[model samples]
Target: MSEPLLEVKDLNIHFFTDEGVVKAADGVDLIIERGKTLCLVGESGCGKSVTSRSFLNIIPSPGKIVSGQMLYRQQLPDGTTTTIDLAALDPKGKDIRRIRGKEISMIFQEPMTSLSMMHTVGDQITETIRLHENVSKQEARDRAIEMLRLVGIPKPARLIDEYPFRLSGGMRQRTMIAMALCCNPTMLIADEPTTALDVTTQAQILDLMLELQQRYNMALLFITHDLGVVAEIADEVAVMYLGKIVERADVDTIFNAPKHPYTQALLHSIPKIAMKREELDPIKGMIPNPYRRPSGCAFHPRCSQVMERCKHITPNVTAIQPDHTVRCLLYEDMPEQVTQKEAMHHD
Candidate 1:
């Protein structure tokens, strides 16, 4: 197997607020290879977005990565490979800045607020290109126009000069993609990029992103709450709850034979065409507040297959199949004493 482009291990990020510390991300482990897409799926406030933002050290104020190792394999100009621990790098220092746009770029959830309304889209794109590359102004502008065209913007020459406000949601998103890919980064972190678009536009954006990923041979960290999108675009899927990944497996296994109760609930929640009249089986209970996260398993409160130990002890992440892993007591082998205790408790 080829070396992974990026690997995150035991990542923990938190936000210190007046209320309390919010554990936005807890022990997230993920891997993304070149030209492959790893979809991070979870409900709102489940740390999917936070995990992606950590890649570029762009987590908003009051939030900080408490512990983790983000190993990034970078190919230098001389064609030599070096692995750097991104978590240890200074967030706003020169080294990270050099890598952020050139080696890895991100498309945030909302393009309207992400793009500056004061500047022409053309200027923004070209400025990003020039920031990482030592290119002349005209050359940068030409490259920006080419990127706009590449992203399927009509009349790229005219559109480039228009401000972001003038474009529709889809158009703005396309412009964002154009800006992100202009540098030909090795990895792209797209956080719910299609959330605000209509279904048709969402499909178009997904298709466009997939096409661009292939063209550039870049790895993708796609964060979304949409299972349908995961089924359509993801080679691997990681199901998260609260903060930790509850399950990790191939896309087909995730959809067809999910092992974690949380994963099962999420899959069951998806509306089905064959069962048109049936109501969606929404997961019971809400995701617990981060400040007062539930004891033991963070997801025990909502997990349908909760066990006695789930409320008292955290289950270690265990591998069931070759590439599939789950953090649930159901998969663990219980000692005879513990089994007898559980049986007596039930009686």
Candidate 2:
């Protein structure tokens, strides 16, 4: 309701493969309120990573942003509303460099990949702290030590001296978080931060992130395929398919009142011990290739509830509630969707 801390509107990304240009992301629109967590959830290769990367203008070259507007908080004095035309920003511009870590930071999918194996974890965090702030080495080191402790790394004094290869996966991830938080960025983009860890470690990392998010009052863009994880930390959820969002809603509305058929299928696919084995539903089709997306509604080919109109018409997002939206004809008449859906089961 208040001005969003960050706004992503009509974002489209295209990649130049050996074969052809692939549309990795299409028409993505999202709003993040200050201190809220928005989880982008879907199956692997659904553009969650690409969308997150685009925020900081890090989508690999040859893969360019075709269209988009990424606006950061408008109140900053250095710049009014930074509506970065991601496609137009020169690599040498100060805008992105200034925001990269100080205003927005990212925690990559793999901890090992993000961490510098050659540097001591302490040195890395301290360097990041000094890079953004006018602080002495001692001050930076002290801040780094404090961050290590905040992330729950055991023996902060000893662990900060270790290299990435020297620690376990969980500890390595904590080190990554420490580095990311060193600058106290306005927002944090976490892309599958728990993907590589074992379930126990995954739970702990998720818990730690939630705690840190609360402590720092950060706007978090959490990307994960796990609906279960979405249930745990997301204040809001966006269900993405090949290159577009099929549904977006508050956590409870998403879990209990899914409007898009794809969303319903996705939520149903989450394994439940309570569900009968045969009654459990799995979505029928694999993700379509980005280069050869299905015409009209991308989900039409796989959607169980697909109608003839779905094959030729790209569904637009229709608001079903103040906080809920779905890209489906079923939601064409917000009120009728509720009545029609209910009538179908009536005697």
Candidate 3:
């Protein structure tokens, strides 16, 4: 097997403020293979976005990555691979700048805020292409228009001249996609790319993303709260709570045989069309304030299967089966009992 496209181990990021320090991402571990989609699913503020931003060292001011390694296996021009530690590089330094956009790019959550209203969409895309590639202005413009067409933007020749505000929500998102793919990056990080669109438009965007991922053969780090979207796009799913990944497995295992209470709650919360008579089972309580996260398990306060150990001792992530891991005490002592309970609940 080939080395993973990207691997993160024990990544910890924090935001320091006058109020308190926000432990945004703590001991997060993830791996993304080439041409695969890894969905980072969790409620808001679970560190999904922060973790993805760490890839490019783009975390905003007051936030710092305290420790951990971001190993990127870069494919060199000579067809060999070089492993570089991205976390060690200066965020705004030349090395990171060379890697960003050229090898890896991101599409942020909101296109309105991500795109500049003053510039034409075409110019923005061309700027990104020129920033990474040594191309003439005319060549960059031609490539930008081609990318816009590739992303399903209609009348690319005309739309390229319009500012972001002139485009609809979906069109703006496609523009963002086009910009991110302008360099044919090896990896794409999309943070809730379809959250603001209608269902039909959301589906179209998702399909476009999948199609582009296939065409470019790029690894995708998709961060979102939508389980339906995960089911549709993710080959693997990681369930995050507070600042930790509570569970991770293949999409089928995550949805059907989830071990952690938090994972089960999230899955249960998804509305089902077949259960017309059933009420939505939203997760109880709310994500705790990052400054004062709950002791032991961060999800313990809201976990239905909570135990005494959960309130006092943090459970280590344990493997329930090959490639399936969960961080919960319920599986530590009586794994069978927890499995039976999950089975009964599903039935």
Best by TM-score: 1
Q: What is the lDDT of candidate 2?
A: 0.84
Name the regions of candidate 2 deviating beyond 4 angstroms.
Answer: 74-88, 274-279, 333-347
Ten-residue region with minimum lDDT total, candidate 2 = 338-347
Q: Candidate 3's residue-wise lDDT over 48-82, tens digit each?
A: 88889989999987999999999999999899999
Each candidate structure's TM-score, on Cα atoms with residue i matched to residue i, is 0.95, 0.91, 0.94
Question: In model 3, where is the ten-residue run with the lowest total lDDT?
Answer: 338-347
Tens-place lDDT per residue, model 2, 132-233, is 789999999888989999998878988878888999888888889988888887799999998899999899888888888888899999998788899988
Choose the strongest candidate by lDDT: 1
lDDT of 3 at 249: 94
Residue pairs in steric clash, candidate 3?
none
Q: Where does candidate 1 stray beyond 4 Å?
A: 274-278, 336-347
Give per-candidate clash totals.
0, 0, 0
**TM-score order of candidates, top first:** 1, 3, 2
